[model samples]
Target: MIRTTATLLLLALPLAFTRPAAAQETPIAYTVAFPNAVHHEARIQVTFAQLPAGPLQVRMSRSSPGRYALHEFAKNVYDVQATDSKGNALSVNKPDPYGWDVTGHDGTVVFTYTLFGDRTDGTYAGIDKRHAHLNMPATLAFARGLEQRPAEVKFELPAGWQVASQLRPDATKGTWYAPNMQYLMDSPTSLGPQQTRSWQEQDRTIEMQVLHDGTEAELDSYVGLTKKVVKEAAAVFGELPEYDFGRYTFIANYLPQTSGDGMEHRNSTSLTSSRPLRGPAALDNLGTVSHEFFHSWNVERIRPQDLEPFDFERANMSSNLWFAEGFTQYYGELLLRRAGVYTDAEYCTEALSGIVDAMLTMPGPKRYSPVYMSQQAPFVDAAAAIDPNNRSNTYLSYYYIGAGNALALDLQLRQNYKTDLDTYMRAVWQQHGKTQRNYAPAQPYTLRDLQRVLGEVAKDTAFAGQFFRQHIMGHELHKYDALLAPAGLLVRPARPGQSTLAARLQYNPDSTATLGTTLLGSPLYVAGLDREDVLLKVEGQKPISAKEMQKRLAAHKPGDVVPIEYRTRNGVRTAQVTLQQDNTLEVVPMPNATRKQLAFRKAWLAGKAK
Candidate 1:
């Protein structure tokens, strides 16, 4: 998945099943109907045939691929019933919150349930009069001990609705096929009145299927931009992955009812957004398209060993998301720049600046390594909770940390090794990603394998080992200013002389201000101020608004001490805090760039497509 959450776009081609069903086993069959779609409900049934046991265990998925969190998909299921092959009522037992155990099945059990979903994003299902957006794990129930069996699904669609999915199309109309449970769960489906465009790339079909409220002209313009993005993304890898079925699809929903998300699958991506593709937002939406398409190589194939064989029963965690997700983050924007969707200045100020600033200013990266940050995804990647967490102070997203690392590494490789990130990516691709085994990578990489590959790419094992030890496994950052100098870019403070308390203040109508999460080393934290503390005065003057607070702080310089009064849970108190300079940074072009610098920058940013 490209975002924290998690598409079905498909192109049909002549291809053999990646995993063929055994002679003795029967395919698990599923039927889905949106009879109550107007009420956001789906009727789903699964038939497990040739069951050998006295009891059959059936369950909903607790986790999704690409998303590291547990989503508890079973909560949306209701009115579950079971029956034997002869249509007799079977005994259904509730063994746990996630599934049911059925007895008296007579070697076959047909399980039925009602699923209600309103959200239209990667992790959940959405059904309406307009369409049915299905993320399989959130829509289907699977039987245990039958995971290796082939799976077939048929959707009973409303009039004029077409199916868009990566799942293999069966000979029967509205039916799709998956060789096994893993592939079935990874495939998302969108059934609606959709507009589709197809093109050939490397003799493989590339498709774009859109469910939108926009005009045909708007869709046409978006497809043009998508073509540029797809071409540039393939340039980074030198070639696209050998997509299963010899095709890849981009399934997008650009409707007001859709939520903003992008999820990558083996051969397709699910893109949902409320933003219309007719204005600047169209380009913004393309950023996600760029990100997810890059994942076809980086994540779907060059996978983390920890995430291979994704567990649908619980949270899936990985220590290499920084590289898996973050490097893709770096390239996502970079590809846009390469495709001319964004100019040099736009890339630097809009994309690079944020990445560099976040790594430098955020306390999380200073306190924890990229590996540690990646491990926190299960808690932060759309995982819901009631209690408050100090993630603002202690946790930085692996996405940002990894992009920062990728930026530094890319520059380091260019400067020190006479190679660049694109070269390194190709190396990783050749070693771990190029070969596919059924639905997964033939050689899923480990942390050590990544380090070894870096060493090989750089042609210096010592430097690679040192680089990993410092920036990846250890909490250390590269000198950005020096590294970016060769390309005529400068990393400098956004506000050079401004003094700040470094705490977000939410001003209340009652003439007081409440603090957001204070940074670990900020002035507020040093003065023992934390989240939910109400500020009454700064330097003995009551600041009524954020502007007033800033006006008061502008009177002082960095290192100046000021008295503040605030109300904590214990009561009101006063403390003296020493202010610090605003450390927010930005990357900008040098004023007098040399010819060599210009050449280097152009070579790095220009499109690599042939």
Candidate 2:
């Protein structure tokens, strides 16, 4: 059997490439066809010159970058077979967790599997080749003995289907080749009919690819947001140099079942949503689009070292996701403002809306310790906890809490200098945002790097640079209402009067369980209880009255231990947890803050030029 030398991309930092780039030349072809819907299940065949040459071994990737999870795409591979050049049977064996060996074969190894392309979210294989989402979550099977880069994949088209992923150059007759491993890995391809549209603005040309089920006319109106996005993100980078820069937006529509989220790729992004692109859908479309668009700068080009040349086997975690996601969170909203697409009232209302959610979530300082949040993300992601007592321990999403941090910091900076966040905002991109390709080659930014950069801008502001440690790094939230009140702004919380329990208490997510655990220091938490712990009965009374429950719990002083039964992952456990007061952030209407604080709040928000 013959195997080819591997090739790579210049500046492609992470991949391990083989020497000489390209050597042997046999045809390698793979065809992923969707016979029914968007789900994919297909077979792959590799043809070389020999009978069991003892030269090839294959393995699948553990996961992909950007998306933070371990999704073993190769789990679906089945019914593998090998044959000699003359079509004789050869022996094959499973060598490791994700590795397979074809020993008694000299020519070809054919792998067939029924890929479950059930959902449109994440990655999936689907029907008609015309309606499939490309490469995401699909197996990145590697020839173990060969370097990770410089490999090839040939496509066996069904005559009517067109190749969709980024793989190029079809070999002599039957094989569709990837040429290099970098191309095989990063360049995503699709196999089906793609709906597309193009429009030009100034020096940039904007094009969008819509992966559809043939009914796509409804999206024609949604293309308008792309121009707005291009303009806004370009402004953040200072300019959208047409000749030097360009971006391609991909809209992957699973029509009836849309994921409603946009994930950014290097040059394109993948999105799934059921909302109509024009009317009410436009609002959500703008948001998801804006977020992913911002990633073009924050993640795609200007990113953390771990992100670039990323490890596909597992997640690349960084505390800086707060910077990557939060700043983009801040900007996703700012883009609307910068484009004049959102009125001041709209922008302010949007900003106000988030504070309410964050407050209810009450994510505190401990959420993301300075040590590592991203590294522990898979285990601690929001999905894992059905109910949490102190969401702070859960490390509220950077999208929400972190965004709040950005707003809060911006307000503090503006209040200090009577200026706005944009002043220091531009500093992030210029001093730290997008400078080069890979972060490892250059100096990586630390939390201190961020502190120094923002500190220099806040030199004269009312806030001290050390405040970043207090609020940003420390997760301390101040009563921002006082700061905003002076500017005729007031955000009052809906009242939660202490009343009797009218209903059995249970977590919103896990109604089946009772007496859920509240975080330490949480009013309910400090009162003694942990998450997943059921309050079988309040004070031993089943269906206890709200009044009685409140009276009993409220009457207890901090450090009072209360009996409780909880079913932990291990088994049923009972304990008396001490009640304690929590240090949750509060946002009472601060109509009484000093004039300077109010000015800072308004200016910082207003100054954000998107």
Candidate 3:
């Protein structure tokens, strides 16, 4: 028999338990329990022991997986102290980086931490009038070795303070349970005060509990449309999974929410949306729900090879985050259309916007491939402008670019099989979803695996096979136009590159005869050089890629005369076009689509058909 990799081994404990202890001291484990309703405040108690000797270390996560931003949970530890049976103090200090070490003895160490009702932005207890959210990363505390050992969590509610989380309640231990620390730390609770609601669909029970000060105003919207959200999400991805089927949560934090985004999870997700759940706001909520809900079928269950047995200490690299994150993003919006929550036009508009966003803006769009980015994530750092939590913003948002590539690839797959993305994705789920828990390996699937199945919807489905190599897995952008042809869509070409006088044109695709150059928008652009002028050399040096081009340009500014060689019809012409900076780049998207585009758009928007 093949030995199971210890890393991939899932204890297979229920994700959340509402029962008591297992009563097996030799095999100690974790159990979590709480009221099964919406909540605004929570009091959690965990039982465990501190090591007898040596340096005992423990810490809350500095950052949660999936949400790449750094949210140091240690800062939220209020009134934190460790003690023994006699309530004696233990010498503890912030040792090294993200952990606290117990300097003294090993006893049943109990650490009490507090979380005051202060939620603002960036996945924490941030509150404002516009929205409030129970975003915990730097807020929740945890036990060391809990991932490997079984631990339990119990919560105490104030008055009628209802409960809301993906965890279950244990009548026995009077606590909630997780198989190990991984699930406990990975999941959190958002409760206190909120309007409560629930509905049942098939075998699964869905609750649309609401949170926020303006609870009454938006309560009806969720209550009225709870079933719709459930049905729509379930339609595309089949029934909700084991833990949560049709279970969609609508949490409102009365704080002024940041302009963009939410985080999706296995059973529940957190949203920092500015709008209410009615009218246009209601529609937005539906879309958010649809996206996160579909995650149950993709990331939550049918996951990739690298993400399983997650490595919380550092970046867990995987070549398939494109599938885990990118494809899930695709299905999130697409599920909305299948569920009738969004129109095809709306879906197309959202999908196209992302594709367009990736075409430009990102400076390193051509520098690193998706697989390289995913694999190198552990060793890379995000630039200041790229990722907010990044010590140095060097990399870009993997979700946006990676998924955009997936989008282009999906389109290619559809065209190859003369089918759509839905067909290929659903099949992958059917086969892999069965034992998804064992996923997260090095070779979850290969180029051929996707290709063989893609041909199911069409006979000559060789396009995606070529696409993965020539574009997605490589440097070139996948053939978007060719892929969209069968589906009757277009990738709307991006505006041409522009340069300044001092900045020599590094590379300009020789598509158009007219040297496509824009006025020097920056100090480099101010130089009289136009874009695509076919630079033969720079400062008497050979011109290469953009990085080298930028490096050469940064060395000189306006009024600084520099030697430049241009490949004009007049042969290599060297001239100094007075250097001036013009920092302007035009980026725009067109709302153009053919009848077929409109037809499929309608089909996707009308929600999934029954």
Candidate 4:
């Protein structure tokens, strides 16, 4: 019973090849196929040359690398089988939801399975007639104890499909080599016709492979702007990381067929969007690209201790998401601006949007600390299900709070010490993220580590400790107005005496307005209007729509009384609510700021250009 490898190689089909025979060789290799693209299925055969004495524990990832929540990837896998070198069947047992335990096999075993992928995002796999986007954790299965062993993966593309991934090529065509399961799982593959471009910056190479339904000229222009982003981001670290793969690939899909996401890895990022890269929607895609590119330095390597050696069987929680994800977000916009992708007005507008979301729009920060939100990421990141809890009233996304923290820190450092958050981040990169470290689960830095670094940078241990306690661990927000003073920026609320409902409203197709979340102590909250309450009438009259209610309320004075009728799960109710003056905050340029303040603001916005 000869194996299928010999026949496949003769046919020029993609084949997985192990290394030259040696002691302690790699335990596993896989060859993948796309036989039924219309059904969105991927067939994979994993051959294990060296198995443990007992049963081999092979499992699908419950959580992916760089993602915090439990995805339960095994739910998408089916048709599992195990065989020996001679193609004879072996005993396979389902021990748990994640894995199959194979026994009654010699030292060598061959496993085959089929995976169904309908979604194409950063975290999930997508297979179709045009292309196959493989998120490894969502498609591949790995043995428990073979994580340290090197692995080889080969793809049998459909017809004229070509492959683009960060995984380096081996001696064979269409095959790639990974140092270990960790690196292999972190690498996502995009196979189809692609618009590929390459460039060099310092000692590293940058590659962009896009499968977009756009012109080659548009792709080139996007790549040109992306190169500028890369240059500006490197300046923050003072240098580029010695990328292990010798290059970084931006695996992007901009067809109208895919859902949108931008996930970061050590050597590449998975960027998917339904939005095309030609019109007004193109600018929004740039933000995702820049944000994920920044992660190549931040979360991908600078290392969060809790997320190190990411677990596949359970949720991997990290409290540094505020810094890992939030700081990346802060730089995403700032670097785009620094790269000349944004005007000064655009940068301020975006920055101010974040500040307002954290300070007033989102009620999460007023009640909970940023650290608490980071800790709750396991339940909230891409979390989708039926929920009864009011997230707006109780939860603010860490990304919002963290970016706000970055803004405050940047301004405070600039005003007080003549340094900025970029300098502090560079120091962190130097200490933990340098390429030589090869950090894993036990090697990540913690909140304490951040404090230590801040203290060293600030030359004030007490100040660093207090900053963390008050701003991060504690719920107190930074003094944004005071911090922004030297930068010629001021936080101001909208004009007073114009009334507002002070609640977020979701308009349903049935012409009902449901309250989503309201600011604490605002007119909505003061009137006891709760989340999920359907608005029925305003001022004793049934409103045609939520917009009409808002327009009517905005016409009244702050002290006017408005009758509100709403329905909750319990019953219908009516109440007389005193409207509050519109107080939404805005970030504005200080008209009376001194020359020094203007200079600092320009320097902060444009970096070297200023």
Tens-digit per-residue lDDT, 452-515, candidate 1: 9999999999999999999999989778899888999999999998999999888999889999
Compose the digit string of candidate 2's lDDT tens values, residues 1-610. Answer: 0000000111135423434434454434445444434335555554434224564676666555455555566676666666666677766678766657766654555544445454444343333344545454454455643432344555545655554443434447444444444335544455445567778755555666665544355557566656676776776567542221253545556365544545565455566666656555566666767776666556555555555455555544666666666666777777766666666557666655565446344544445532244345454432234443443446565555556666666655555565455566566566654454321223345666677766577764235455656655565555666555555456653323322222235533332346443543454454444555555443444434444455676666656666655555666656655554322223343546577655544443343334
- Between prediction 1 and prediction 4, the one with superior TM-score is 1
Best by lDDT: 1
**TM-scores of all predicted structures:** 0.96, 0.73, 0.69, 0.93
Provide the global lDDT of candidate 2 against the true structure: 0.52
* lDDT digits (tens) for residues 462-512 of candidate 3: 654665676556757555555554445555523223234423233645421
lDDT score of residue 212 within candidate 4: 91
lDDT of each: 0.87, 0.52, 0.51, 0.78
**Number of backbone collisions per candidate, in order?**
2, 51, 90, 3
> What does candidate 3 score on TM?
0.69
183: Cα error in model 4, Å: 0.9
Q: Write the per-residue lDDT of candidate 4 for residues 297-344, one digit (tens) a residue.
A: 787768776665577778777788888877777788888889898876
- In order of lDDT, best first, we have 1, 4, 2, 3
Worst-scoring 10-residue span by lDDT in model 4: 2-11
Q: Against the true structure, candidate 3 has what lDDT? A: 0.51
What TM-score would candidate 1 get against the native?
0.96
